[model samples]
Target: MAKTNSTAVAAALTNNQIKRTVDRLAALKAQIANLETEADNLVDLLKYQGKGVYFGNAHKFMVTTVTGKRLDSALAQSFLTPAQLLKCMKTTSTTSGRLYAL
Candidate 1:
């Protein structure tokens, strides 16, 4: 029934705290973008110099060529009728969010 020193409970955030949290998230996103760019560059360099698999201190980075398949809409449209094209096609709905400077 009684709380101990180790029992940590979160206090409710104020309106200002909410805004500060959002601000922190926005800054983190920017940092993440920069880090991603640097990582991509490093990966490219490693792929050029290293073999198929890269050895890190605690992890292994495997670089493999990915062959993807997708419908050639323009070519398909030329060959198939409108009704046939509609039958073959699929509508994909995806969700994403971004923060803007206002």
Candidate 2:
């Protein structure tokens, strides 16, 4: 008879659980996107702005202003230059983990 180690079995089960959780999360995000589109359509139909409520749930509506700067490469090359732009830029590094099924 072959003996199986309990520790190995537990680790494999844990990995499988993690993979399943990731799959479930992806499905949930897709559902959320669909729901958000529906909500946006309803808000547009009602011409809602600033705040509102549905089924006794309190909701606050907001208009967000997003501002960004785009570099004029031609001007930058003639004047400040790419090297100068690099000097002002901030670089970030991050580490992330993903679970996969076998």
Which one is best on lDDT? 1
Per-residue CA lDDT of model 1 for 1-85, tens digit only, reads 6455332332466799868967987999999999999999988988887558888899988878778998788998999999998
Model 1: lDDT equals: 0.82
For each candidate, what is the lDDT?
Answer: 0.82, 0.69
lDDT of each residue in 1-102, candidate 2, tens digit only: 534755445454567786776798778777998999998897785555434433325765545446899988777778876788789779999988654444
Candidate 1 runs further than 4 Å off: 1-18
In order of listing, the candidates' clash counts read: 0, 0
RMSD of each: 6.3, 8.8
How do the predictions measure up, each by TM-score? 0.68, 0.47
